[model samples]
Target: MLVPSCENDGGDSKIDIQYGAVINIQKSSSSDTYINLVALQNGGDINLGFTIDKAVGDITSMDVVGLYIKSDGTTIFKGKFSTGIKTFPYTLNINKQKIYDAFTQLNSSDDFETGDQLTISAELTLKDGTVLKLINDDGSNNFSSNIASSSTYKVFQAYNVSCPSELGGTYEFTTTNVKAPTGESAPGPLTGTVTFEDQGGGIYNISDASFGGWTGLYGSGNIARNVQLKDICNKISYFGVDQYDEVFTFSNLVVNGNKISFHWENDYGEYGDTTLKRTDGSNWPALTL
Candidate 1:
């Protein structure tokens, strides 16, 4: 359960959009445990928020209000008072064209991962100018589109991911002081000829770094960043921000001929945006996965 604080990480992010509906919990003859949630939807930003009182459970009552104002002051989609989906917790899914735009807004943030809770509420103006809340927790409810693939997205900038074939020569990698996110590039010159030896069975020697994971993943995260000469296997992929607790592995890189290339990144980022580095290309800071 995440406590609603006045800060995000170290940066304080707060809002006053306490409008919409509320989830009131009523057990068998028990006190009505009202769960107050606040959702601050930025007018013209790529981000939105859902704040709920508890990490779990559903709220039966409360009318959620929402507006579907378009570019020309026209309501593209309209809705009245509703209840949240109890099974899906705090998510309100309107099965209309506006659903596409809503997805774009939700996917703008980089915090889409498992265990991350998404609560949704809406408010509507009645004919009498009265505000009402709607939506309830149900299985058919969808807060946003499902995020498939654990593969991480890497952005490039200063140093881009390079392949051995890109070097077009036999290059060697030797690390003097290995580090994370930042460190001195190895084998003397930052730019030089690179070589890749494909040893079949999910194993490749990139300069001094080895990459492989099980089931197209070569191995696991433990074998990726460390100096090892083993063909480890892992069936997992993950995204990393600030720090990566999961392993990133490469696979099935065979050296049929010479001039083989290896793509790698020293990507380190946060929630808003993640940038990557490319090997001096048309785009300085590009996006890589």
Candidate 2:
């Protein structure tokens, strides 16, 4: 009888793994994440500091650039920074003059406005001449899931341009017109007291966006309370959805003295025109659509 026997063979399989460098951000270095236009005009600067993680790869040097992302999805290359970095930990002190100069180089006549964003990204060069970037040219991430999930590994930093806003207070709301979903005219001439609570960053929470018009037509429980107003550089706009999951749009907005009058219509054919007057005798800022 022939017995089949198995012999152990020394065979092995190996996998090669590559690791990239990471930018460990120190969030405590930057106080605010948005650029205050008022402060920038007053000679303020954007401060950001980070360190390269040498534990992953042999990173020799890093080059960083600034990008201006407009509100209309337009991206412009601002300029590169003179980091003068010779060590792992680096601090970037970007002054307002540098930003202004970069913007002027692109468009001398245009100025930085609200609703714009500024992003700083970097490219790391390895000792073997391999360059690694965490952000793509189109402002997208190029890191893997594991790297993206790391809290300290930051690819880029962005700051939004905004103006100081203080439009929150008590107001007298007067409804001039109201229309139901059936296109039939509803009861108008509604008046009430509303409150605009400041939520910071140019956002205000209205007590009732419809200003008692929806309550008069649909009752108190059905009135819209989830409406918000955004004031970016005095440009007023609507935010959030109503109780019925309908989005609202404002039109014919006029600001005169201490009064703000506008016409609002929802996606479901509900519309109302209301005038809000400040009850505290404070003059409202010049607001536009």
Candidate 3:
């Protein structure tokens, strides 16, 4: 269980509209326990909080408060509030079983594969029977439309994950095969040999990088800076500065054995998908620090 502090927004002097609600997800102290597939399966808990400001009357009872997934309009877990907050602050807890059930519904079947998303969000019903919706000016109780998008919904993909092993080696990869979007030509098929070094703990250092006839992805003593991961097959978390010092990040990558394909975008707003396959590393120079 987690306890998070919340602050209520100052309300107007109006009579009827006395309370306003805001929900927040608390950050876990331990990074490892921060909402993962394994933890949810083992009955992990989600910590949540809210604040009700300028109550005209004491909050005697709350009808309902819970964590929900907007995708299927399902409420996986409901929180319990033993006593109402006669004041301004309150917290809630969502059990792991709720989250696990939601994910299981998303998966639709027994097998967990890549691209299955866990879309988590919060919902609550006040004592006056008003259901909260996170919209600009939606006063309708029939909330057929105000759900949050999957990107901002604490999204995580389910994959057949395995530990990184024997993946270290030098390989030549070609970038010319990338199919550009409509009205754009390919990146002109540049080939370069890059190295992947296992740094343990699911982290891999990528270096000696180059793509599309450009160099410097790992330069300026920055060979170890571009750390990526064979994280949970089909899910790649990448962060680094290229040789030109332009920052880029990769996500939703598909890794099939020695091959990798990903959607990448840079700080300048340029983005594309690049696919790479392992080539014979026997003739490639050994990785240098």
Give the Å error, residue 117, model 3: 6.0
For 197-278, candidate 3 gives per-residue lDDT tens digits of 7643234567733333232231234332343534433234553465455565665556555566556555544445555667
Worst 10 residues of 2 by lDDT: 1-10
lDDT of each: 0.26, 0.70, 0.38
TM-score of 3: 0.34
List, residue by residue over 79-196, the lDDT tens digit for candidate 2.
6674434477666555566676655554321456687777776777777876876577676766665565466466677666778788888888889678888765656788888888
**Candidate 2: Cα lDDT at 229:** 84
Clash-forming residue pairs, model 2:
none
Instruction: Please tell me which predicted candidate would have the highest TM-score against the true structure.
Output: 2
Runs in model 2 deviating more than 4 A are 1-34, 46-69, 74-111, 117-160, 183-185
In model 1, what is the error at residue 153, expressed in angstroms? 22
Q: RMSD for each model, in Å, please?
A: 18.2, 11.7, 12.2
- Residue 4 deviation, candidate 2, in Å? 50
- The order by descending TM-score is 2, 3, 1
Per-candidate TM equals: 0.23, 0.57, 0.34
Error of 3 at 14 (Å): 24
Error of 3 at 66 (Å): 4.4
- Misplaced by over 4 Å in model 1 are 2-58, 61-83, 86-221, 224-263, 267-289
